[model samples]
Target: MSLRYKSAEESRVVISELMLPSHSNFSGKIHGGYVLSLLDQIAFACASKHSRAYCVTASVDTVDFLNPIEVGELVTMRASINYVGRTSMVVGIRVEAENIQTGIVKHCNSSYFTMVARDDEGKGIEVDGLLLENTTEIKRFLKAVKRIEMKRKRREEFDREDFVPEDYLSDLENYKVKVTCTDEL
Candidate 1:
């Protein structure tokens, strides 16, 4: 009967774990894929906390690995709902790593996961709107709106009925890639 709203603070989730040797890649740094798994988990927790429903990750909007995390470092991830639609919410996550001995910290990653609330029958369910309490929250919500619009426009531009590969061939000339066309192609 009435619209419901929840604040970003209410949806916040934070977790910290020590990077272990088992989680390291061949080069001895923490694996990005492992970090991604953690990010997805936190996103789900934050979204579910906000909506009070089970949520599934519809898409990973962005993942920027700014720094490599090393084994033996303390990794912390913070997730919060940045935007909320009728059935979906964008969870913003920031990852940081700290060197225990030196007390040095570095930002490891920033990511956004779009999650959709689902019911028992796997149907999409309505979620409460975001309650923006401060300028920071307002900015994040606006940025999410812009990102959605940009993604829509990108899809339309690439999936146009008259799309032609040849038209974009020149666009790739500046890259280091070399294109070879087969007779059948």
Candidate 2:
């Protein structure tokens, strides 16, 4: 079978919602959970558009809340396919909040969601490859590749049978934690 290809633009999705008082936290700022739910929804839409199959979020890589969003502001989320593997696509999402009266915008957060395409039988299926048209698209794809490699390395090193916690104890010396183990080596 011939391999299908799709441009990054074809999978882009944008959504805007007005933050309400009901979505606010005790501090009167918009709840982070509500924003995260919107991000996941947009990621799903973009992934499904590109893959043309049912997609599920495999993991959420990075969710850095840069700024606090206030209630009554309009929140906008933009999502696009950053990188594509056989059956997985990394969807990058950028969130911004705008004050309707002041016409000022602030970047709220940025995140990456890894989604896997599945067939009707609930089996993983191959999806279309990405056709990068510009330098920005290429850069995003490379960044996603680097993130995946780093994650794999971390998992391999920490999830091994030969892993020793004492070896990493010195690495945490600058942290705010006290190690209290009764058993001796």
Top candidate when judged by TM-score against the true structure = 2
Weakest 10 consecutive residues of candidate 1 by summed lDDT:
176-185
Q: After superposition, how far is residue 59 of candidate 1 from its true place, in Å?
A: 0.3
User: Local distance difference test, per candidate?
Assistant: 0.94, 0.96
User: By summed lDDT, which 10 consecutive residues of candidate 2 come out lowest?
Assistant: 176-185
lDDT of 2 by residue, 90-183 (tens): 9999999999999999999999999999999989999999999999999999999999999999999999978888888999899999888775
Please list the residue runs of candidate 2 whose C-alpha ends up more than 4 Å from where it truly belongs after superposition.
Answer: none
lDDT of 2: 0.96
Per-prediction TM-score to the true structure, in the order listed: 0.94, 0.97
Q: For candidate 1, lDDT tens digit of each residue in 14-33?
A: 99999999999999999999
